[model samples]
Target: MQVISITDLNSVVNPTRLAVPIDTEQQHFQLAMKQTCMKLPTEPLLDAHPQIDRWIMEVGLLFPKVFEWEPPQFLVDTQFIAKLCTKKKDTCVQINTNAVFHRNGYVNLIEWAIRHPVLNWSDKVKLWVATEYLSLPPENLKLTILALHPTHPGKRYEISWDSQQHEETRNWLVSVVTKQATPMKTPVASQVKSPFPVTTGADFDIGKIEEIEI
Candidate 1:
């Protein structure tokens, strides 16, 4: 919901201790998040050729504990997996990060995404989000709409932010960066490309959500 300025992201900083469990240092998460956003693919509304790769890269950089999955799992559900599964007939999503690791940072990012208060899609019931990533490896930047993680298997939600809600999310983002998390900013008034395509005032989602350095 909060479309962060790719430029201003460099200066933002959060002092509060992050409960996120990560392989790389705190700096890595911020860098990876921003870099992934920066490299987001642009041009059309339907394309993940680059976005998916960026997602995997950013996640890996931020959580080095998570190695690159050998055979990425684009979608997670058992039924869906059954449908999308390749000829090999492997049942589980091959995780990039080795041996099913769970870190606080991974949990927080997923949780923050779900309860973002921006795009209301998920529920409060926590369903091992780590599983969701395995179940559904995001393939596109628009997939960022998948921001909210699953709180429960049965519950499903979707909300579009109006100007007010967008403002709420945007402001909340500022707070998270300034106080809640140790994030850096890139300063206001910096010229940055819009991450999403021509939204045409769409109801939800992002085309390219993160920032990348030129």
Candidate 2:
């Protein structure tokens, strides 16, 4: 049997994609996976959160018509329904016996987009929120910016911010914004298909393997 480093596996898969250096440590790889999940395209929604797959299947079975509609119409309908379900609390149960609501309701909209390719949705939605609100401090921000809506009168969302929390939030925001401003360097190696199944764990001894087959 042959053994290989996580770095080798990542090089074969896509070097630029992984946020953490594969050779560093197993715990780092896990953290990288979590961060990468948020950055990756929405097509990998199921991969990022496998639970969404089950939710999608359940939702599809309960609302077959959702699959039949055009992608844009499906997106609009599901988003509207999700909002109602979140607000009314009873809307999910009323929709179908199998229907269940998630607190992160927008997830259903994402899952719907994944199932329907015509929508051309991407992870840019996350970036849009970041860019729009980057200047706003975390403390005073609302759950969302409703003032942008045409029908709503100018009402601001407000939250209490303690000094300690405010400082921490500010530091974090600055770090993230600074990182985003920097351009990422691409690896010199060309992209190649991975031959081995790559896995990360804390217990694996990197020194024991002679050669990784992949």
Candidate 3:
């Protein structure tokens, strides 16, 4: 949640400290540098909506070098920062610019949605009926933004498409969204006590066992 600015790189990485000699005692320093230089993994989106995926890809291509498909990181965590003062070439411009562009774009979209009220539906049944009949291709599906109601902060805007569709398609989309929102529960293993305890060394009585005919 911390918005790390480009100028705040010093807070995450100290150039003077990394300049220290890499001896046996400074192994941790080496490990830290390795981790900092490693590529960050990207997180899966809430839903696998085709349109949304395409939109994200398009945004990334706008600044191909900056907006990579990997997880966003603080300026200091980038490889560019690690190579900043070193003999390595500085390649931090793309990431920094990409981060700013991504953050600002989302902020602007949210603000615009809050200010404009294109459609309002008070009836829940009507909204459901509308959504059930709606049909739109990935390309035609306009960028629909949802925000908390201005007066009623607790409630959110109900998004619906303007076209009609079959009941099957409506149910499928609903199921997809529902499944994505729900968190998966992992089963926990319980510990059980053994019925018998065995003795070791001299206490181990193999002679006490009686031979039985099978």
Candidate 4:
């Protein structure tokens, strides 16, 4: 609920300390991010929708990047941020720009981006804003961002760019956002009593044996 603009914070905080809190925020944003976005390992859209994942994979292979797929990134995240802040279909260049920087960790980079005279209030500078709010490992986090209609949209980038896919992606992201597991708490040794006996030697096996089969 405490959504801080990525660029506004960088002005006051140290870059190093800012990193963790921002990362923590991104972890928080995942709920919102995954909710309205689509990715590979993408889930069922109404369980009856056609297979978008396979389509994205196939489209990815066609790309020049020998890596097999362009791989879903925060392009979708920034786009949504643009939507969240602006109810209007048209996005602000600064807001989008800030979202990009915010998605990525360019705490220092934002000041430079805004100075670009070409940036328009209506333009929506998505590239810069997203840069500040980057979250790592969700790719391996068993989620994927893929297109909605494979044939019509063709690929993730193309689909993401489509104005029509915006709501669909947002709807999908919002649904799964809560499903991603919370960061697991590490179990403390003292918190969990070992079944093993505290005293060794003669009584070594007794405490640990909660139940005896014989």
Identify the candidate with maximal lDDT.
2
lDDT of each: 0.27, 0.29, 0.25, 0.26
Per-residue C-alpha lDDT of model 4 across residues 111-192, encoded as one tens digit per residue: 1110111222122223222221233211211111221221233222210122333333333222222211223254233432
lDDT per residue as tens, model 1, 36-92: 434433333224233333444444444443233222222121111111122333222
Weakest 10 consecutive residues, lDDT, candidate 3?
Answer: 107-116
Error of 2 at 36 (Å): 28
TM per model? 0.21, 0.20, 0.16, 0.21
- Judge candidate 3 at residue 40 and give its lDDT: 32
Clashing pairs in 3: 133-164, 133-165
Summarize candidate 3's per-residue lDDT along 1-214 as a digit string, tens digits. Answer: 1222222222122222223332331233223322322443222331422333343343233323323333443222221111111122222211111111133222001101121223321111122322222222312222222221223221123233334422333332233233323353531111111121211112223234333221
Query: RMSD of each candidate?
Result: 20.1, 20.7, 27.1, 22.0
Summing lDDT over every window of 10 consecutive residues in candidate 1, give the lowest-scoring window.
Answer: 75-84
- Where model 1 places Cα greater than 4 Å from the true spot, the runs are 1-48, 68-123, 128-203, 208-214
Off by over 4 Å in 2: 1-59, 75-108, 112-175, 182-214
**lDDT at 135, model 4:** 32
- CA deviation > 4 Å runs, candidate 4: 1-47, 62-124, 130-214
